[model samples]
Target: MLFKTLRWSFLFTIIGLAIAFLYDGVTGVTVTAILIVLEVSLSFDNAVVNAKVLNRMSEFWVKIFLTVGILIAVFGMRLLFPLVVVFVTAGLSPIEAWDLALEKGNPDTPGTYGYILNDAHPLIAAFGGMFLLMIFLDFVFDEDKEHHWLGPVERALSKAAAFPGVSVLVALVWLFVFSRIFSEESADMLLAGVFGIILYLAVNGLGDFFDGGLEDELDDEGERRASTGEVVKATGKAAFSLFLYLELLDASFSFDGVIGAFAITSDPIIIALGLGVGAFYVRSITIYLVHQGTLSEYVFLEHGAHWAIGALALLLFVSIGPHIPEVVTGLVGVAFILLALWSSINYNKKHRGEDHVVHV
Candidate 1:
């Protein structure tokens, strides 16, 4: 199962490494390896959340995710998105932005591609941070959700979820606080943050609207048993809505890593190769989890991933003024996932032993 799922990822890793080595010898190879590790670590939670969404998608859309979705993630986000950012933020033309990126100049220097992109970090962070915060808030604030990993804290939050637009209110308050604190870029920050919130709400609403009647068709275990052709049509529309949400989610998560890559190296080629390969593995993992029913089995894993996302959101807001170490970001996420895995295993053990008991 593992080999079947990861075959493409393995193939891409070899190709990415070869490209890196041919581009800049052993140094390129080393940087590429570091980037793969960095991307995979930072995005493990992304995979978890992706699997949850992907679980609902049909096989056809799943293939689309592995193929067309990957193209968007690699070239679009890793490569072209940075150029576009430089184009817009640095007020450069398309050719100029492309030329600046190819120059591979030092990030510390003014007017370099890296420096411009880094300078644009506040906007990127604000936008991505708020989007991610909304996801975390939605998951925890789901009043109908039965599972609670954090116990009292989660329950408390769920109780508050009955209020309409509570998540939006909290997210707005968060943005306001951070905007005031980073008053120098307060206007830009608030604008981008509000846009992020709106984008999340818009996509989420579309998904919900398309999926409105889906719950009625599903059985107790949430499997669709209906035979109506209309159900099939609705399913496809819902899947497409979900596909868009997933793509935007991927974009939000990739924003930080793309900007952060400049700190390690100014070469966009290497960044694309490395992070692209890592993205393949994340997709592979998401597929593996969906196929194996890992989330259903592990139970709390999704909860942990959402919590990590919450932490990352806060970190993004904090990073507007402070320099946060990548190690700190990666470790916090890993810690939550590990703790959740342990708790899940224990829950399974206790439940498994009870399954064999006979009732009087």
Candidate 2:
């Protein structure tokens, strides 16, 4: 099952490595390998969260995610997005930005491709941070969420859901505080943050709007009560919303990594190839979790992924001034996931023993 699921990732890895080798021989290959590890480490939590959303999707949509979605991820975000950002922010034409990228100018020097991209980091961080923060807020503040990974903390947050728009209030407060702290860029930061919040609300509200009818057709456990054709139709619409949400979410997560990749290497092609492989692996992992029902088995896993997202959001905010190591970002996520997995295993063991005693 694992091999079947990850076959594409394996294929991509080989292709990415080959391109890297041809581009710059062994050194290129090595950097690309490092980038793959970097992308995977930073996005493991993303895979878990993706599985939660993807599980509800039909097989047809799932296939779409693997094919069309991968193209968007690899080329659109990894390559084109950065170029576009530099084009707009640095007042360069798209061709000029692309040429600069190919020239592989020094990242630290002024007026270079890398320098311009890094200069735009604050806006990127603000936008991505707020988007991710909204996600974290919605997950923790969900009143109907039965599972509690952090117990008292999560429960308290959930109870606070009684106050309408409390999450938005908290997010705005955070954004305000951070914007004040970085006074020079306060206006830009605020504008980007507000845009992020609005984008999240728009996408999430639409997803929920489309999903409402589908929900009515499902029982408590999410099995369909509607005819298969009806469910498929609903799923198609709902899945498109979800697919847009997922793409945006992935973009938010990729901002830091894409920026950080410049620190490692200035070669856009290498970065694209390496990170593309990692993106494929993340997709594969998402599919694997859905196929094997991992989230259902490891009940707190979703909670953990959200917590990691919260941490990443805060890290993005923090990274506005002082540089936080990519390693630090990656480790924080892995730690949350591991702790949640351990707790889930213990819970299962205790419950299984109780069930056995009752049976006896």
Candidate 3:
């Protein structure tokens, strides 16, 4: 089984490499590998969150996610999303974007690394800032008693129109309108922000709906929960649906990563290789989460993932108005997740009455 799985991964990797080869030879290979690592690092939290949702999906859908979903993520999102963003934001025609990407004149060529970097900075900042804000608000306003802190402003906001989703929508609409009053560039940036919001809401809504249905089924103690096979089947179905949702979420998260990469290099091959390798690690991480039952074992893992998501959302919002460093954005998110993981470990130790004991 392990060999078979490895074989499939190998095949996919080769295919990815082949595509990269078609674009550029050695440079393509090297860049693609780098992108894979970058993508994987940036998306570790994504895999964990995905596992949480996938655990409730069906077997067949899980297979599809591992196959078809992976293809879309590696190719469609990593390769094409950047071009789309450039086209939309930079007002470059598709052919213009392609030519600019493939042109080999100089690394410092106009619309090359330097130009793309300059053009992409605002978008990157907008994405990062939005992600950060979402994180802060979520951490502050979380309703769970164990996580709550009382602050006057937070208290006021909490009491008055407490729906976070509504706040996000209102903010997005405001940004959209604000952009129109400003320049076209600002409008494009704001549109990206709106897209990010819509993407998050759509993915989360679908996941929640599916989760609710599964919960309902599990609650039915009669025919639905009758046997082990039945339970497994139900779990598998839920896992499949969840896997699909998770893949979509992963794609959403990749938006910034994909676009940001263009600032470094426009070579489609390099981007593919680098991001694809990163995706491999993400898949491994997701599998580890699933096998370890991290969500169940570490009580706060899910909470942390949710916090990370909220942080990412804020990061996206900030991306609209200000320039934020991608590295900082990524680090802040990772820090929150690590903190949550550490807290979960501590909670587990305490619950097991092993907190006082030194394991090592």
Candidate 4:
């Protein structure tokens, strides 16, 4: 099983690199590798979170996510989304956007597309701020309460094994608000907001819908020896859900990375390479977390991740005002997660006894 897993990982890596090479030769290969690493590193927390969600999904959806989902992630979001942003917001024609992206002979500075993105700092900041703020509020508000207004919706849908459609409503609200605020000149801002929300909802909803039922099936605890079966089931659910959550979480996390990468380079191939490389490391880290059961053993890691998410949301929301730096926003999240990890380790040491190291 381990060999098979390793082989598949290698295959995927080769394929990813091949795709990059086809797009831009040696430069593409090198850049894509970097992106994969950056995305993976920046998104380690995301994978842990995704595991929690994935354990709940059926095998079919999991396969779909790995296949079709990757395409959307690599191409739709990383490659196409930026172009769409430029066309809509910057008033650049599609051809112009394409030209800017493909412009050659400029070695020292970013291309026309990069310049456009730089000029659109306010817009990027808006997205980053809102994304960060959402993370912060989510942590602070503890919106997952069982008896809140959305509780009934959650429970009713829980039985049906679907996520509460609250994400759609949230997206709509985001569209309306941004549309009203940024629509005076063009509806691009509204369109962008809607697109972002829809992306969030689709990824989030599918994860919840698939994972909810598996968790439901694991509730019975009466028939098992050493209770090992029960523990495995419970842990499996937790791990899977965690993974799914992390995937969605990483998508959310990418809002800034995507924007930030534009600052460095505008070549779609280069951007994809750098981000994709990061994503690879993130996947590895998440697998490590799952295999090691870091969250389960540590206890406080989940709290930390949630807190970090909440902080990210707040930061994203604040970007609307255009004063915040993306680096600071990212650092805040990193600090929160690190602190949580430390606390969890300490807690485990105290509770599990000094001689015992908690393993997943």
Predicted model with the maximum lDDT:
2
Candidate 3 lDDT for residue 228: 41
Per-residue C-alpha lDDT of model 2 across residues 240-325, encoded as one tens digit per residue: 99999989999998998899899999889999988889999999999999989899787788889999999999999999999999
- lDDT for 283 (candidate 2): 97
lDDT of all predictions: 0.89, 0.90, 0.61, 0.56
**Candidate 3 least-lDDT 10 residues:** 145-154
Error of 3 at 42 (Å): 0.9
Model 4 root-mean-square deviation: 8.2
Ranking of models by lDDT: 2, 1, 3, 4
Q: What is residue 142's positional error in candidate 2, in angstroms?
A: 1.0
Clashes by residue pair, model 2: none
Q: Looking at model 1, which ten-residue stretch has the lowest summed lDDT?
A: 225-234
Question: In model 3, what is the error at residue 118, expressed in angstroms?
Answer: 6.4
Of the candidates numbered 1 and 4, which has the greater TM-score value? 1
CA shift at 136, candidate 1, in angstroms?
0.5
Name the regions of candidate 2 deviating beyond 4 angstroms: 215-234, 353-360
Alpha-carbon TM-score of each model against the true structure:
0.93, 0.94, 0.70, 0.63
Candidate 3 residue-wise lDDT, 291-334, digit = tens:
66777776666656666666666565555456555676577668
- Roughly what TM-score does model 4 have, to 2 decimal places? 0.63
Residue 30 alpha-carbon offset, candidate 3, angstroms: 3.9
